[model samples]
Target: MQVLLDTLAPADAPRVADPRALTDEDLLALYAPPQQTWLRVNMVSTVDGSATGDSGLSGSINNPADGRVFATLRRLADVVVVGAGTAKAEGYSPTDTPIVLVSRKAQVPESLRGAPAGSVLMATCSLSDGIGEARELLGEEHVLTYGSHRVDLPALKAGLAERGWGHILCEGGPHLLRDLVFQGAADELTATTVPRLVAGSYPRITVGAPLDAHLTLRLLLEDEGTLLGRWFV
Candidate 1:
């Protein structure tokens, strides 16, 4: 890891001489948000602005540096929020961390099935189908229903905050990221730009209606040809 630019660094020096020598704790500190209650998004993209590669998946476009940052962000977060589509596409499974699967539909992904009790949650709307099945699988307390038409992101955040999950990390599949930003719930974005070009019809990090959200870069790091940036929304 090469420290290109960091707003948190001293004015005399804008970059670290040997960021690669930093330990995991150092990395975690570098990416920590200023606020205790924060919504931080992590995403990977290509140089050509495509979010996916030939396989139409983010993993195909990610590198080891991005993976390190991803893991560190997860470690720093109190809860991990992800769209249902991305969870299935990325083959998400249970870990020590709790995961909240957000979906407009009530169907739970196959990979999340049989997960340990209280390890995973389903977040959907009251209008979704299969609500009974979702409640039965994840337990009634684990199934969070907010809006009648869609899962209200703001309400969901409040609910999670009420549960003491102040540090929120969203690993998106695009649509979810867009909604978070559009809803003004995103506090920061940590994006990694892989030094590769994959021109296709793939989506960007955020998809959906056009947004004019502004982001200010707070930290920038590079490893090999990859660029990892942290921006406040």
Candidate 2:
């Protein structure tokens, strides 16, 4: 992908023209793949600051254009990670990339249970909750465990790399994103800010303990009310 750069006045500036148009094919072509291991967090939110609906679904946070960008991001990922709560709430299915679920308590919903053939992976901290059914449904290689109070992120990344997965994408429900950011594991964040406003006390993109270090980002592209920013850790 190509690399494109732009400047936004400031985060507190008033809205001018829609920014989504700047994220055209030309800009997307300029995006460079990260060297070594990489991870990106993707999210969409309303102008009025809501990440989901009253029913807690992100599906209502985007339009067709946003959906297109979301699909493109997914297509570029080697693995997609989400919390089990998100998987259940969003009724997630395994996509072209391998689906990874992070559950400290092994509470993955039955509806979003099975993986597509050999493409699902579950990361848990314990084996007390037998994965017998999940193993049968997704095959043995699909289930994984860290079995520790704190996961070894570097080790997990190495393991994924050994399996030929270097670019990981995180589609979250806040908690998972928080963990990744808190652990200093996320490389970039791609957020789509929609034109409409949905006022509420709903979630924002990153929710967790404040970062000890500042996260610096460059504005990559803006179009039709959407802004894409890239950050380096």
Candidate 3:
């Protein structure tokens, strides 16, 4: 893999200028063949460093600008993935991209049963749980079952490819991100850090364990209230 840092420099001299003027979308163009295999992990925190609220909601950390950026990223992905716990807590619905929920027990909320026909994929470890609402509502074929232990991510990717899914985007609730990072399944990481801190006992971004060797990231862009960093591992 290759790493690219897209930043504006002074025209007169070979010096760097302001870094907080470029957007993540502008920096993403540096990646060759945007349609190629790519995954984006997104997280939001408050000005005090808190990632979640008392009710365990990430929406508290997100603003209107963040929402727009998220939606745009979702549009670029072929499959949008999240943990089932996150789906239930966030009340997620199928968007433009197909939805994939990672659940060991295949426990899906009845409210999300109507997830935009043909755009839902439930990834579960157990086959005995049955599709339940996903079957009668979203069609039987939309549900996918994987290993009972750790998910065979490579196999899942191959399966998704067979079903015509190439680009995958992972929107996290921390634990899922940690698993992906630990498994070395994440090819690329796009993180937007807002200029705020929310200090609390709640959890922040999870990466399973501390890296033995630091994973280097290129500073892609930094806008007024956000900083976009990219890493290739």
Report the C-alpha lDDT of model 1 over 71-146, residue by residue, as the tens digit. 9998899999999999999899998889999998877889998999999999999998878999988999999998
TM-score of candidate 3 against the unseen true structure? 0.77
Off by over 4 Å in 1: 9-17
Best by TM-score: 1
For candidate 3, write residues 99-205 as lDDT tens digits: 88877666666656766777777776545365575456657787776675656665566677677777777888688777777666666666656677666687776
Tens digits of lDDT, candidate 2, 1-233: 12235433445652334443334443344334446577778888888778886777899777765676676777677888788888888888766678877776655567656546767787665453655655665666776766465554555656676788887878886877777777767777777777777787888876777766466665554556565556554
Candidate 3's C-alpha runs over 4 A off are 1-35, 46-49, 127-137, 207-213
lDDT of each: 0.89, 0.67, 0.64
TM-score of each candidate structure, all chains considered together: 0.94, 0.80, 0.77
Error of 3 at 63 (Å): 3.1
Tell me the lDDT of candidate 2. 0.67
